[model samples]
Target: MSSSKNMSGGILACENALQRLLEGKPVLSVHVGLDVSKITASIVSLEAGFDRGYLKKSRRAHLPILAKIESVRAEAGKGSNSSSAKKVQRLEDKVLLLEKELAMVRTQRDRVLTQNLQLWERVRELELAERQNKTRQVRLHH
Candidate 1:
């Protein structure tokens, strides 16, 4: 009885995962506690109303559902691909804008540095002229 309960639980989990996948939700095989092949088999089994014997006897009946599943998966892939491309393009545009801003910042920094150097040079020249004036005054007093 315990084993049966566990089996039912696993089947229930597999069914839920399969339903999510069919609904275009992200459902990995690992999430369902089953490998890829097992998940595929479980999907067919679940679609056949948990009748494995019937599934084996009439595999054709489940083919249409399987095809539909495949198409849904393909469409999802395409949708993700397009969205990913859009994101990449947006990032590239942002990078270009950042690069331009960085260049402008660097140019401003260079200008400020040049101005600071010029101001320092002017201070040194003023100090030198003041010293010369003091020397002349001392000569006149002597």
Candidate 2:
């Protein structure tokens, strides 16, 4: 009985910690005696918050709970029985769209960078030619 009580208490503490995290509050791993990384990984697996890239770039300690709540609401809209399946499909579609968009943006960035490099090379060539012309004129006059 005592063991069960302790287990229940631990569970309650975990639940409370999760609640606080969801509320955009800071939760220390030491306070909850839980691995924050594991908890965040589970949240990421559930597709809560933004994409992995955004999360890594932002270096946020916890996932944004608002996104999770919105996702849950969107999933709930399609009935409970098929919600998970539909949500997975929807998320997959979103990933595909984002991937395509990312590819296009990368192509544009590459093109722009190439153009910039070419412009700098042209500028350097022009400067060198002008300097050579000035040197030639100076020698001819002398």
Candidate 3:
């Protein structure tokens, strides 16, 4: 093959590799002796918070990466159930926190309402006293 043809082939291969990497698929090749390419990574197969170092560093990159991972031996039927369990736990925690805050706010509101009622009663009492004192003075003068 001519040099130009060889260069064109190389360019095509590089383009394909870049496309796979951008699509978040590993650059898997038989030459690598693995099912997945080591450079590309996908978060779907990985458990949350497993690769903190890689996550932190690659977070700034524009293209998605695919990482090669070995098939881990997992217990039977354990995968689907554990995800739901985690979601339920997180929601329960949020609900509990909200309930506690609601209760405290209700208590505070009740106290303020009670204080307002007491103030209204005090004002009524003062008005009644003033009327009675004024009537008594008028009768004494007459």
The most accurate candidate by lDDT is 1
- Which ranges in model 2 have alpha carbons more than 4 Å from their true place? 1-81
Candidates 2 and 3 compared: the better one by TM-score is 2
lDDT of each: 0.62, 0.56, 0.51
Candidate 2, residues 66-133: lDDT per residue as tens digits?
34434544554545557568779999999999999999999999999999999999999999999999
Higher-scoring candidate on lDDT, 1 or 2: 1
Best TM-score among the predictions, by candidate number = 1
Q: Arrange candidates by TM-score, highest first: which order?
A: 1, 2, 3
Per residue, candidate 1 scores C-alpha lDDT tens digits across 1-142 of 9966765654555455457645545344433433232335445455434543322325444455555546655666667777789889999999999999999999999999999999999999999999999999999999
Per-residue C-alpha lDDT of model 3 across residues 35-114, encoded as one tens digit per residue: 22232233322222133233332433312232212121122134537766988999999999999999999999999999
lDDT of 2: 0.56
C-alpha RMSD between model 1 and the true structure = 8.5
Q: What TM-score would every model get versus the actual structure? A: 0.51, 0.44, 0.43
